[model samples]
Target: MTDIARIRLLTTVEHSLDAGQQVVSLANDEDPLTLKDRVGSIERIELHFPHFTDGRAYSQAYLLRRRLDFKGDLRATGDVLIDQLIQMERTGFSSAVLKEGVDPTDAERQFERFPAFYQSDVVNETPVLRRNTPES
Candidate 1:
């Protein structure tokens, strides 16, 4: 399993998703852009929550996966905690970028905090087929 790592920096939303450009995005609080729009062209999105208490990025990540079906890389940066790491994965983030000055090795151990599966209410049963007697 190859751990996803940050390779580049994207300063603007438009620039990040543009077909002509591929840059890692870091969103700020005042960006005023929805996660749906941001992920449309983004190759990878990094949510920047200035504080742990700030929950906007959580919602953003959720929308990216649940609503937009974003399959590319997703990461959380800034003010991340052990408590939030599992929720981050549940919300559809593929990776987490430890805050500055933190050791990246420690994060690999954080995976134990979250359960592996999310049960859903929707169900589909396999259809059964019965053969009818041949007409004589």
Candidate 2:
């Protein structure tokens, strides 16, 4: 990937998804509903959570995956805390850019805290009860 398209100093949500860029970062308040039709075309989309308490991005992630069927990179950016990584992954975030001060090793461990998920999520599209395989 070219640095021009791959590395961007994103501080806000002003990205206009284009063929040239591999990533598009959005703000917490930006509505994915407005971009539904073209979401599938983008190779990667990053949803920002400006604050740990703001949960709007969670819905945005779900809409992109379950509604728009966005199958590419869904990354989490800004204020990404250790406690939220697993949930972020469950909500369709393929990767994350943790804010300063959060240790990468600790975050990695936290992500593996839940080896099994129950409900149907982006990580496991099939609900445990609906799976054909036997339960653990």
Candidate 3:
């Protein structure tokens, strides 16, 4: 995984951010591409996951990263689970606020358990096999 896609695990919703940083929170149904014009001005974007079963936020994150090219922080909020962290990191979330009662330690272990992926991700466009192989 690339450094740009490293996921920061947060146990609580409360965050200490810089005073000047601009944050925009989007509901699960909101389309991230709509904010294409405002991407530069915003410093962070929070995408909501109303429930564990809902996956709209994943699409939003992909659009923001690959489509709109949002370079600032992308955070996952609400109903986040430890099992989703690996996929979340692959999709482009820089941080996630875990749901209540979910152990942060266990969430951290998820990364350790699956250290690498073969498929390409938003941060790492090259597939693992392609990255390792040299042109003949």
- Give the number of the best model, judged by TM-score: 3
Per TM-score, what order, best first?
3, 2, 1
Per-residue alpha-carbon lDDT of candidate 3 for residues 1-136, written as tens digits (9 for 90 to 100) = 3557568877674554433368999999887888999998888899998999999999999889888888888999988989998888889999898888888888888888966679899878898789878799
Give candidate 2 regions above 4 Å deviation. 1-20, 133-136
Q: Per-residue lDDT of 1-136 in model 2, one digit per residue for the tens? A: 1111121222223223223466677788887777777876788888988899998899999888787878787777778787987787777777677676666677778745676767877767777777798767
Question: In angstroms, how far off is 50's CA in candidate 2?
Answer: 0.9
Q: RMSD to native for every prediction?
A: 10.2, 7.1, 2.0
Off by over 4 Å in 1: 1-20, 24-40, 113-136
Checking candidate 3 for backbone clashes, the offending pairs are: none
The candidate, 2 or 3, that scores higher on TM-score is 3
Q: How many backbone clashes does candidate 2 have?
A: 0
TM-score of each: 0.57, 0.76, 0.90
Candidate 2 clashing pairs, residues 3+ apart or interchain: none
Give the C-alpha lDDT of model 3. Answer: 0.85
TM-score of model number 3: 0.90
